[model samples]
Target chain A: MPHDHDHPHSLLPPDPALRVKALETILTEKGLVDPAALDEIIDTYQNRIGPRNGARVVARMWCDPGFREEMLKDPMPRLREMGLYGRQGEHMVFVENTRDVHNVVVCTLCSCYPWPLLGIPPGWYKSDAYRARVVREPRKVLAEFGVDLPGETRVRVWDSTAEIRYLVVPQRPEGTDGMDEPDLAALVTRDSMVGTGLVPGPTP
Target chain B: MSRVHDMGGRFGDGTVAPGEDAVFAAPWHGRALALTLAAGALGHWTIDASRHARESLSPRDYARFSYYEKWLAALADMLVARGIVTEDELQAGHAAEQSSLSERALMAGSVAGVLKSGSVYDRAGPAPALVVGARVRTRRPARNTMVEGGHTRLPGYAAGATGTVVRLHGTHVFPDSNAHGLGEAPEPLYAVAFEARELWGAAAEGDEVIVDLWQSYLEPA
Candidate 1:
């Protein structure tokens, strides 16, 4: 098996952490980049924006049919209005998962994911194993992710090779009719929007 | 031609470890990502160009480097190639001289707005050639092909396969052209749906795979 990190015997820098620091130092000295800017960008993704943004969007869809229909028909404008439009998410598509269908997203060519809503993609999403195997054996891949659908449910794997980004609207769990938007959002997991994990049912 | 990054279905890739879901595995990973993005804001190269650099790595290097490592390597190469940085400066870990490009720094305050109002590739172009429900076949991969070493959005598994166009994405930037210093040359894009069997034979058990393919990659079947 190929090791994910650089080989210990390789000529490349033995310590990647130091290499990154050196790169930053040189770039900073040249005035080509600002350390403050890097921090801001990292902080934005790490703290400000994340799966919670997507969870709220998904929760709204579950509570309001009109919003869901509008979103499914034309999502970019709606997403923009909600401050969820940005880099890696300029063009968006929401693939709804229903009783008969299940949807998942992947970018085999590279790791292209929706950043504004979901933040950076998880580590596994960019793994060669997932990119290579998911397209061929999606059922098996989903099962490994602990998502097992009924045999009758059709699986649609969306390969995001172009500018279009996809988000899967997982089926709302049963017996959550009384939950409010925030409550519903709390139930939505990052994996559900990515179609790897289902939203759990309301607690007993 | 198939590249190392185009691994969609050629077996023996092993199992996916989804539990390793941290956005940044180490301190350096986040810095690598931030540095790459910050450098990218210089307008020195297009996103397609950067992607091409990453995909152009030797197979051995590509396999050994982790995801963020690839980004850093490609970013360094692009910086030197674009004359933004030099090998000496990189090696010495210091700047040799003041860069004239200082005016183009992406400031901390502007980061939010710039990221929010991202680059737009959608451009005015001719009408789409194929419509929804149109049957199409992707161009078959040849041993030596179009713009050899050029980047492509087409994955190896989908090449030469037949599928139905389920949706039209309108004309957008074609990566094949854009990645090679060619113009955007926007083309109609479509969501082509193929049964798992069509792509991987009866041994493949998935229900379907819908790929967003440019019109240039397809022809009426």
Candidate 2:
């Protein structure tokens, strides 16, 4: 191991992907990382956990008042019971949308979202546009997302700053009270859970 | 510390593209994420510290680096800074071919349990400085600048800004102090309500932004 380079100039690769590969190689070789563990982590975030999990919870809350009441009391334990508990979602706080009040979430400092419930955050949620303006112009931002509220419906933009990650429980649309859990879940969308867009209206 | 990552209140950030969201745009992004989290499991640094490193890149690098590039830089920086890995090894992209290190490595079967028992930061702490409905202001650095220079959770837009406490959240870790290897120093977190005008002047109207600020970031206004 005759590494004779005195100067510690950054030898990091210029290419982003290569740079990532390089670091992965180093960590794996150093026994600092496990490729198998990495795969499982990535697999979980990619396919298993995401907005659908949140949507399931949202639908359950809509159809089952008992569950909703318990969730409102504190969603963390309930989410854990449902097996939705995980990183970036250790603490849970649910904000409900009513005819009088609407809620949206952002992280002004950085992009922090409920990873277990919402899966990986969408790019827009992490983009500078959403983080900067949503706080100042919630109405405008929501409108951009095609979520227009009544003039009297007050909008509250939540900045996910601390340990608490917010899940916006949108109001269930009128009609169709007989829908089952699976159908209700289908109606719930990711943006709806995020407070950016509404759940799909009963198929026209 | 770089206000670079704090994009709140800036203008003309363009429109959010509409489409299905891909968890990771590239295989490397996933690798970058996995590497970060695996290192995180080792507990050498807090999540806030990793975030600060990712956000603390030089302005030019921060601006130009792609998302995962930033992650890569942060991971490398954290490793070197903490002496977990050396710059020489990182640069060489090859270790001295050692057999193995006895460090605690996350195993495949343990992913579910590790994530389910995610790192907890909400620890009991001192009583809250301000109560719900109390008017408060976010403190700023001595000299005024849009950005800060340390590991801070206080966003530039909210610094020195006035707001009202709408809800009292329980004690939670303060990210500002935690990023520098500072102790968790848990504090009461509050949901502070700021009218659009208060945060963005007349440029904003018709809505309010509620930020969760730790007790230390607030003072009676």
Candidate 3:
């Protein structure tokens, strides 16, 4: 199907939703795609996988320094053992959030995200605006996300490619030394894990 | 032949805002994504080939389609190009007649196993020429036989700029060559770190960006 002229671009549906629905119906009717498998995929990306998994990993690391060392040294073995494995997350690299340096992740080419750890990426994460401006004015871009840092603090953006994906491990909250792993995990937010937001203050 | 998809350190695009967590804005988006992944599991085209299909569209068309629409378009292009489906069948939403080709079905119960054991892109290749901490610059690798313009993982923003190899990711399938079934020719990949000042101008001092670049994209600065 040569897509320039024979394919009347004008004939296509302006409404994306309907176009997709029509395509899906055709593919299913043709028996090329299994309906049950499609449902499982939608459900898996929608619910089964998400930032909560990454939070658990981060919390365990914060609570157990030894685990952090092992995870930092070689995460694939430890991550697989922790059940944190999936497509787009084949080779996981955890970037630490320290007082002086903050890490932010973006896929400028086509939104290479860590689906296993962060679930499906947010719409903005894949938007033209974020992909273009974030690399140029990261501080300003981050400030729009309500993240303001001291002038002294630094930022590092990871441009993800197909070979590797990055997950930002936010710094542990202060005065959380007494908190258990679950409690510490509770403090980890999705944005924080992405290094675009601060870890929530300890609960009273 | 720079594809519009290679956007990094590109400025003046506007404000970046947080978005809703909804996986799909419409039901079709979800189905579109599922169908692409499902059909892709058939192994007719490599992931890089599929990506090149989407990126090859005229920039106007590329920007026109929504994310899932692009996915659907790429899926249609691949199916037709591979002879698995005909334009007439695609247009009619049914087979013209019985297609002899058998497509594998991924069961719901096996979704986890299938996704968990994702396709590995690494392949056998020569030893890496450079190690960590070595300074290098991105280069346009030599190509032959196909169209001069196509998809590449190398972001244009850092093509001529210099950076240091902070981490080496061993050898992996090179997407540029892999897109054309140009053998599994794996090459060492590196996490090259560029200071913000080096990428931008004095305006971006004290910041840094790290990109995962293939071995071919690098040359000693």
Candidate 4:
């Protein structure tokens, strides 16, 4: 394979894919990293952990009054009880979105999101546009995402600057009565838990 | 001075358009993320140090690189800076010498356990200086600049702003010190709520911004 600096000018690979390949190769040769370990890490986030884990929590909250109250007041213990704690989720906080107030989260400095609960952050969540705009004009940003709120609903933006990870518990949609846990969980979208969108009403 | 990564409240970046929802938009993205995380687990440097490397990129590069590009670039920088790899070696896409640092290699079997038990930042420290509901003011950076040669969690927009402490988060590792070679000086953390109007005056809308701030960044209002 021709190296990035094969020429006298010393140019890096123009393609990011090539650069990533080079890095993995170099790290593996140095014995600093294992390729199998890398694959395992990728598979874990890409498959096992994601918003589905968070949805189950949301559905339970809708069904059990005590669970919802405890979660809003204190989330870490409740989350730990369900074995839903890990990296990027060391310290968890639950912010409930209500009719009067809506809560959203962003990490302006870097993309600090709840990886264990929601998996890798969506591209928009990590984009510079979202980081810059959401803090200043969340109402406008939310509207762009097809989420328009009443003028009276105050918005609260949580800038995650520390180890504490926040999970926005969107209000349970109306007419969800008699639905089992899995049934209710199916309605919870990733956007609702992130506070960009709300859970929609059940289909007639 | 604030870096390009400290983009909170600044304007004209662009519109917030959603993109493909896949965890990894490309195969290389997954490889880059995994490589960064696996290398980081070798106990080479603190997570804060990694963050500083990514933020320290030139403004042009910062704007140009994608999210995972930044991660891979920062990882390479850290590897070279720590003498684990040479610039020539990186450019050549090969290692020149075997590293004696393989003792802490994150093996495949240990990957799950390592991620399962993530690094805990909480440390035993003195009681919190401020309590919930306390009125406090965030201290501005020196000469309106961030910590010289050190990293900080305090964003520029929140500098010198007055807000109420909404919640109390116990002592945790301080990024300003941890990012550098300094030890983990755990400090009391608080979720301070500042009215949108307070931070952004007339430009502000009817909303509030809550930032998790360390005790050292706050003083009695």
lDDT, candidate 3, at A193? 78
Off by over 4 Å in 3: A1-14, B140-147
**Residue-level lDDT tens digits of model 4 in A39-141:** 9999999999899999999999989999999988888887777888889998889999888899999999999998878999999999888999888889999
**C-alpha local distance difference test of each model:** 0.86, 0.79, 0.78, 0.86
Name model 2 segments beyond 4 Å from true.
A1-10, B97-101, B142-148, B203-206
Clashes of 4: 0
- Writing each residue's lDDT as its tens digit, candidate 1 over B1-221 gives 57899988868988889898887888788899999998888888998999988987778879988898888778877777788887767666778987888888889999999889977777789788898899999988822235886888888899899999998887899888888788888988899999889998863454899999988788899
Per-candidate interface DockQ score: 0.56, 0.59, 0.59, 0.59
How far does residue A184 in candidate 3 sit from its true spot (Å)? 1.6
Candidate 1 vs candidate 2: the lDDT winner is 1
- Cα-based lDDT at residue B28, candidate 2: 82
Per-residue C-alpha lDDT of model 1 across residues A37-111, encoded as one tens digit per residue: 999998888888889999999999999999999999989889989999899998899999999889989999899
Ranking, TM-score, top scorer first = 1, 4, 3, 2
Give the true-structure RMSD of model 1.
Answer: 3.4
Candidate 3 lDDT at B96 equals: 64
By summed lDDT, which 10 consecutive residues of candidate 4 chain A come out lowest? Answer: A2-11
